[model samples]
Target: MRRYGPAVLLLLTGAAVLRISLFGDLYLRYVQAGLRPYLIVSGCALVLLAVVSAIISRRPYDDGCQGHRHGPGVAWLLTLPALALLFFPPPALGSYSAEREAAARAAQGVGTFPALPKAKVLDLTLAEFGSRAIYDSGRSLKGRTVRLTGFVTRDDDGTWYVTRLLISCCAADASTSKVEIRGVEAPPTDTWVAVTGTWHPEGRLGTDEAWPAVLDAGDVRTVPEPANPYEKR
Candidate 1:
């Protein structure tokens, strides 16, 4: 076990770096709910464990193991949690969260969305589309490539949403973001999936008048959730 310590540390370090790099922006956007403190605690524990292992490895083993393995072993064990983080990860924000947090879309004052320019390709994130729909009818999102990641939250009715949560460092800071995914193969609720489709707005008046909802799916697939599931973009 000691011999494998360095390998373990290496893996954990990689995971921590990955989380920081990929989710940093998303974390900043929604750093509420006391999530940051948990990160501080966990990070300190890992640093302390790594340091202690280094110290122990330097001390000669009275048992005469022939090499310094204890230090590395401790380092490896310290990494287990972080590696698990990269795998069996937390589910992103879904329908369960939609009602809990103020709707990301609703927050935008009632107005119509901007019509997407014809023949122009605009790329948007799930939050962008959802928020736009809430603020205006759906004008901002008309006719654009929207890329979103989330667990499927479906009602017995045909309506479904593609959603993900933005976490500051942990679950507490999680903020729900989602888009209406109409007209397509609906996966099971809570299943992680990716959708590449065009936005559609329904209704012809009021805030709905400005932006109209439209739906066009180019591709849909069940994909593994990224280590950092939130959309920084």
Candidate 2:
């Protein structure tokens, strides 16, 4: 068990890297900020455990450690928090996202929106789209089908929302925009997906529409996260 600790740490490090690449700053956006500190602490603990384990094994340098073997239980102490995280992750992708989405709607004004072209893709950041949608509300999106892509973020209602985080400087100043998409949809967490639909106001505050503004959507397909995930929206 001690011998495998280093291998396990390496595997976890690889997994963390993969998750960061796939989700971009998703972990920071959705998960609590405190988690970053926890991750750092856990990493240090794992590294320390590996060093101690290596010293015990002493296979490569058997000078001082003639016959020292660490107990298997030592590994468990280092693994407790990590296992807990795997078994029960923090509550993320909930009310916080909805609150931010609503806040975005409030900030949008009449001047920000532009007349969208037909049969075309709207290449705007989540924040830009959100601002425009709020500003124009029902008028701009009605009867016009547009396509947008981003990561899936969940709201408090358990209804999956299509969202993208827009950044001006970096992840620290990032903002998000969301749309409640229905019809052609499935779960696509932490994955890039393209949705096509005509805007239909859901009749919420600020906008004369319901939660979902896009309707009769077509070609909702999953794709990869772009290299520059953040856009000036």
Candidate 3:
């Protein structure tokens, strides 16, 4: 059993990966959608390696008669996470993660963004609205009723924002984008919602003061969390 620890770990981990990536959108909770293929390949490889390792270990190897080695007794404990991956995959990052992120905009300087579409109400990601609100010299979000969807997060003062994580590749590298929502009762933290509102400018564009954009919410409706929780930057 001790000799099989690594093989067991690999097998459990690979099956977990395949369960998340090959069968469904569960991988979206942790990585960008474009990365699904890579994850699938990696899972398949791990499973194959585990099978090969187990087969090779079963082959007879001659050793001059002696007592058995310890065979890394403690190493078996490492399989706990692999087992967890199989049964209890972690939830996507939520209000706790959002609350810890600082309220600073990226260093993108103020500039004119291209005009928005002809639609009456624009559907925008938190990242898009936050960026436009903070740095767009044109005030692109001005006068446009927009809808944003994200889980709720709050500050110590009870100010709640529609918050979402933006990832470059995976959850480990995710950053937060949020918009302070006003004129509506605060929802419980981490409750997903669609917020329809107009931008409420807070400060001068491109300045630190204008960060973490504000929205004057006209309507707030609880919604199911989306399939892909993180926005890929």
Candidate 4:
């Protein structure tokens, strides 16, 4: 068994990766959708390598690793976490992740944004709303009723935010975008909600003070968490 330990570990880890990436959207919890092909390929490669290693290890060997000492067999224990992905993948990033990270991503610069559609209400992503609310020179969000959805996060002083994470590639590199929701009762942390409101402006445009934009919520309701819960940066 010791001789095959490394191969078994590799195979199990590879199976777990395939279980998440090859068969379903679960990989989205950890990485962007565009990277799915790479993940699937990697999982297949790992499984193939494990099979090859096992086959080679079982071959008749006169020397049987004659000179090289095997590393500690305890290395198999590292597979525990990897294998867990097969049965119970971790939840997507939520309120705690939003609060723990510095939520203020620097704006590229203050600029005039494109005009809003001539509609009574607009559906917007948290990042889009946050950027316009903070950095748009035209005050595009002013007087416009918009609906936004995100998970809930709160501050100690009872302030709460509708928070979402934006990732350039994956969860590890995610940055936060939050809007403080006004005129609504606080919900449990991590609960997903759709908040419809007008922009509640605070600081001057394109300034640090404008960070964590505010919303004057008109209506708030609980919603199902999205399957792909993250926004792309």
Top-lDDT candidate index? 3
User: Model 2 over residues 92-198: C-alpha lDDT tens digits?
Assistant: 33334434644323433455356666655655455545555556634665555577777776655766657766555445555666776767655646667877776
State the weakest 10-residue window (summed lDDT) of model 2: 89-98
Question: What's the TM-score of each model vs. the native?
Answer: 0.51, 0.50, 0.94, 0.92
Candidate 2 regions with alpha-carbon error over 4 angstroms: 1-105, 118-124, 204-216
The deviation in Å at residue 172 for candidate 3 is 0.6
| Top TM-score model | 3
Q: What range of 10 consecutive residues in model 3 has the weakest lDDT sum?
A: 63-72
Predicted structure 3, TM vs. truth:
0.94
Which digits, one per residue and each the tens of the lDDT, describe model 3 over residues 1-233?
66677789899999999999999889999999999999999999999999998997676555731223245577888889988888898999998887777766556888999999989889999989988998888988889999999999888898899999999989999888889999999899999999999999998888878887999999999999989999877
Question: What value of lDDT does candidate 3 attain over all alpha carbons?
Answer: 0.89
User: Candidate 4 at 142: error in angstroms?
Assistant: 1.2
Candidate 1 vs 3: which has more TM-score: 3
lDDT score, residue 177, model 1?
A: 64
- Each model's lDDT comes to 0.58, 0.55, 0.89, 0.87
